[model samples]
Target: MNAVAGAVQALLVIGGAPLLTGLMRQVRARLEGRAGAGIAQPWRDLRKQFLHKETVRPRGTSEVFRIAPLVLVATSLVVAVVVPFVTTGSAIPPAADLFAVVALLTLGTVALALAGLDTGTAFGGMGASREMTIVALVEPTLLVAIFALSVRVGSTNLSSIVSSTVHDPSRVISPASLLAAVALVVVIIAETGRLPVDNPSTHLELTMVHEAMILEYAGPDLALVELASAMRLSVFLGLLANLFLPWGVATSPDPLSLLIGTGAIVLKVGLLGVALAVGEVFLAKLRLFRVPELLAGSFLLSLLAVASSFFLA
Candidate 1:
């Protein structure tokens, strides 16, 4: 039953990621008074790239450049399967440790950063350097923020933390929970290349962070990179939703519960994506040097959350 739930969760995340990206764009467009390319545009774009474009290898690039996409996608898939999006029980329970999950995500980021460096392009190396800087701050905040939640539950297994939340809903309203939520929100925005951290839509060399690394990729490789990115955004949003709002997630692996959990996660993640898009409309990208300040602030919030959780317990 856990396996089935994991499979369903992976399918939903993989299949719905593109739609989620499109929905955010559509929301942004409407807010800006534009008709926008429809909600299916990302899907269409992915399909067209996959079917019509040829994968191109840059001259002098190493095997890291060739295999980075696979590594990114694989790590995302592992995270999707292990995370308790649809159910409290992970298919691979042993691998569902919060540290393990964070490491898997970091691995994907490292893979892309290494690939970026391997390209030997100035933009790629710059992006990789900037990405690593962000990662250094983001990862600790992520762990500590989640640690704030795990403090109450006495375990760092994501399933355990979430399951505990399910049983004691009042914990969600605690000061620790609130602080951690805010901290996680910041890290998620940073981790996913959202506004105020890095602009996903911009290709200008000065502003490029995530986009610069992939400028050397084309066709199928680009498609894979894009797909992995969409998946990462969905994964982060899903993690955010489930961590703070674990109400609709399944406590048992029953069929009806699993179905409800699936729907609940989709709704929660969609609402988060929409909220992020709306917020982005008003936010300008932070200057490259100032990005660390925002992340540092989030890290401070996470620390406060941890302190509050322990002291107030």
Candidate 2:
């Protein structure tokens, strides 16, 4: 039963990721007073990419360049399975550890960074360097945010954390959880290459971080990378949604509950995507050098969350 539920959850994430991305784009376009691409546009884009038979591999690239997209998608799928998306009881409980989840996500980032370097292009190397620098600053805050929540539940297991908050809603109102949420929000913006960190819509070499790394990829490889990027963003948003507002998640193995949980998560995530779009409109991308300062502020917030959790307990 857990296996079936996990499969359904994973499929939802993989299939709906592009939709969420498209939805965000649509919302942003409307906010900016233009008719945006429809919400199904990403699906269409992926399908078109998959239909193309031509793939271009640079002259000096290695297997790492070819395999990074697969690893990235696989790791994200594993995370979707382990996370309490629709249900509190995961298909793989042991892998549901918060630290393990963070580590798996970090592994995916590392794979992409390596692939960027493997391309042996100046642009790729530049992107990789910038990405790693951001990762170094973002990761500590991410870990501390998780630790703040874990301190409340007495375990780093995601299920335990969700269940504890679900059974006792008071925990959600605590100082630590609020601070952690703020910190995680900042990390998500930076980690997903959103505005104020790296703009996903831009391809200019001067401002591009994620795009620079993928300049050498085409056709199927590009499709895989694009899909994986969407999935990663969706997974991060889902985590933020489920961890902070777990009201409708299934606490049992029942079919009806699972269905309701699915609906709940979709609604919650959709709202989050819209909120992100609205927020992005008011904010301009920060200068590359200024990114560290923003991340540093997040780190301080996470640190305060940790202290609040320990001292307020």
Give the best candidate by lDDT: 1
For 97-161, candidate 1 gives per-residue lDDT tens digits of: 99999999999999999999999999999999999999999999999999999997899999999
How many Å off is the CA of 220 in candidate 1? Answer: 1.0
lDDT string for model 2 (1-313, tens) is: 5787789889998899999999999999998999998999999999888896478889978999999999989999999998998988789999999889999999989889899999988999999999999999998999999889999688999989888888988888899999999999999999999998999999899888898888988888899989989988989988998888999999888899999999998899999989998999999999999999999999999999999999997
Per-residue lDDT value at 310 in model 2: 95
Q: Candidate 2: which stretches are off by over 4 Å?
A: none
lDDT against the true structure, per candidate, is: 0.94, 0.91
Per-candidate TM-scores read 0.99, 0.98
Deviation of model 1 at 176, angstroms:
0.8
- lDDT computed for candidate 2: 0.91
- lDDT measured at residue 173 in model 2 versus the true structure, 0 to 100: 81
